[model samples]
Target: MVGVEVKGTTRLLGLIGDPIAQAKTPSVINPIFASRGADIACVPLQVPAADLQKIWAGLKATSNLIGFGITLPHKQMAIDLCDSLDPVAARVGAVNLVRRERDGSFRGYQFDGRGFVRGLQAKRITIKNRDVLMIGAGGAAVAMAFALIEAGAKSITVSNRTLEKAEALASVINGDFGRLVAKAGSPRPQTGQLIINATSLGLNETDALPLDPGLLHPGMTLAEVIAQPEITPLLSQAQARGIEIHSGIHMIKGQVDLIADHICELWS
Candidate 1:
């Protein structure tokens, strides 16, 4: 750990989520602030979705609470609570970063999508002109697919338990990035260089891989968006077969940076 210049009066940032114990924000964001000589500390706040509005209102009233990193259910709710929203967040209809303005108003922005693209770049993965096979069409999945297309991915294939949900996300992506291939037919598509898992699958005892590991090839690189249970079952299976693996931790760090940038740009 690097030493940082901090006064007794330093401000704080935090993450708000229902199940925040497994989050990697503190581990990643705190070090980032320290290394950057910022007089700030990021913490984790476990707040359920039902209490989000109440908590957010109180947070806005507090002076020491510099900003917040929202997760899961809170992301969508934060958008509703914000006095203003960044265009990216508005388009995605979600907010993962929130900070108070000079007029005592709070604004929200979506950073996860930008972070996913940054994480891929940090790992030397190229989305431009690459065929992507994304598993899961959940919130994060939708955000990543949209971000990937914006980053110039040649084409994408989204797979989810419900084919219609996957098709919905694909439609949105196609609406922005040209023709996106949707695989809902009997035969699943097997051609893709990048395989990303944005599902909460393989995160707990009750969860399992969305698809079989036998389908993965060694040439394929996998990116999982689940951080808890660090080595998810999907990642474990991929490792067993020698497939390149990118952990959810990378995305956490990437999002932290994007949020920090937003804080400095808009708040500072």
Candidate 2:
């Protein structure tokens, strides 16, 4: 890992979210910037939901602030603050990364889903024509659903504690694709070829597994979006069953280049 050296000319990039203590973006992103010999620094800023707008406005006023990242509750809220949204972000209605344009305007883009898909592809796991069962219908799930459809997934089933939210997410995807590409379903692992846990179920040690481990089979691929534990309980169980596993770290790693390229453009 390259050492981080801060100078007066170093560019500022931030990861903003409520309860940002657990964010790993800085750890993963700063190294990339250092390795590339770019004078860019990524830091985490804890901003409450009520303070987001004020904080965002203040950040934009800072001349040297090139870009930032949004996580959790902020992803959906950041959409309204952006001057423009990337096509994928507009369709997903969420933004994970924001770049300051040449005109000093902010452009929002969602990379969570794209990162997840790319991570799988990097590991030789194919999503095309595969049946996917995603547990959770929040911002991350929405992004992943659209990406899966875009990547040619045969079908996707969304399951969440609040069935209404799951239904709404499915509706959005179906509406966008003009086909029955997504649907709402229960938490029980179905016959899906790809099983994903996009919820915070595995964030805590005592949290229950998102799906029944007994239902996992050797031919299936299990994935999660929780990066903290690295090896989530769901993935651990899947591993014991000989099921292929994809951790949340891979998702973060996969998007590092995309995020770096976007932020670097400001300096270029």
Candidate 3:
């Protein structure tokens, strides 16, 4: 097996999330750095929700580090931790990428939505006028809801365990779009023409399905934001039922180039 050589002069990059073993960022991105002969390495940090703030300090103090990618719970919480945000991330209220400056201040950016849209487009999945049921009120969900609407999805229902969080996210999308294309609703599998699992529910075998599999019909297309276990339990169920399924890896694959370029710019 081949690997990038890490040495005293190698720069560092991190990907942080709970249950991070399922993440594909380091494997997907580190090779780009190697091919370009960049003295950089991306590593996964398995940080549960409770310890994010505790570790944020250590991340900031690492001089050899550029910044880290955020996922799951940290995506939203890291917004406050950032010294500034790209307007897209500010509007989405979640950050997927951060660049720590020489002064130790972190600037945040969100590319999840763009990547997701590009993924769907690349696969020729029709987004225009499709009613979407997005499960999750966290960072990735909020960003994708807006992207879906902007991509001409007929409407979107943001569903989450906490009803208020779902409602709040829908409200932001509607407010920003100046239309009622998004709203809070339960995760009823039959309601959406396109259903996306944006939560971290599929990271482990013990996690529950985001919705009732029995309700998934043949006409609907299902997608995800969880990159590992490409065939998540939900996707497996959907595929068994002959429903069109899209994997989470496509989302990362769609945007990895942007990520590599952003890091190269920062390094320069």
Candidate 4:
């Protein structure tokens, strides 16, 4: 009786993604809301890349919907759709969470960066002065790379399938920090203290590993941005090879409190 009691007055939130069946945001963040005795519930909203614009309009017009979360393919696309962005979201050029204002406008925010750093820090996984090899150059990758540097990562090398995209992301991060901490390189992962798979490659059974498995060694810790399946092939392979691995679940856990406050406006 001391938990959330969803009723007519309960507000709703959603996690939107293309292949949403595996998302852990709802399960992870719901309990935090319940503990606060708030009448809020978050559900999954599966929308293909094509239908995102249409769904965004609908979610905005709906009542009792305070905000929603974004993941995967939509994080970058959702940026232009938002009326405004929080500082981090603007700086990272991605939006993972959006709050619907009373006047039918939406404000976007990015927690992926700080949440990621917190996730690793919570486990005593050292980030400071570490060299990071990040796969993919999409929205999430962009945020994490910046955060890694902020957390005192000595260097970050972005490696994407498309070499140009990786280079561009590195250029952006470096230009922002003005310290030349991030650079674009191949996915071969020649050198790094941490290896991050920030791509969608491991989301499917038939997907290939983001990097050369042979390149992975004991010196690097493999981390993921995918939450579902709990253990992706990348993590499994890395573990089998005597490498330390971190799952996307920690990223989910890392963002729970931030998500709660943003979506429910608990602090407001």
Please give, for residues 150-260, the per-residue lDDT of candidate 1 as tens digits: 787777788777888878777876665546453432213255578888777776867866777888877778888878877888888889999888888888877887677
Per-residue lDDT over 14-101 for candidate 2, one digit per residue giving the tens place of the 0 to 100 score: 8998768767788998888888889899988999999999999999999888989988778888989999999989989999998988
Tell me how many clashing residue pairs each candidate has: 0, 0, 0, 0
The per-residue C-alpha lDDT of model 1 at residue 171 equals: 80
**TM-score-based ranking, best first?**
3, 4, 2, 1
Q: How close is candidate 3 to the true structure, as a TM-score?
A: 0.95
Worst 10 residues of 2 by lDDT: 186-195
Candidate 4 TM-score over all chains jointly = 0.95
**What lDDT is reached at residue 6 by model 4?**
69
- Writing each residue's lDDT as its tens digit, candidate 4 over 94-152 gives 99999887676798999998888999998888899888989889999988988989899
- The TM-scores of all predictions, comma-separated, are 0.87, 0.93, 0.95, 0.95
Off by over 4 Å in 3: none
Which residue pairs does candidate 2 place in steric collision? none
Q: Candidates' lDDT values, in order?
A: 0.76, 0.87, 0.89, 0.86
Highest lDDT: give the candidate number: 3
Where's the lowest-lDDT run of ten residues in candidate 1? 180-189
Candidates sorted by lDDT, best first: 3, 2, 4, 1
Q: Candidate 1: TM-score?
A: 0.87
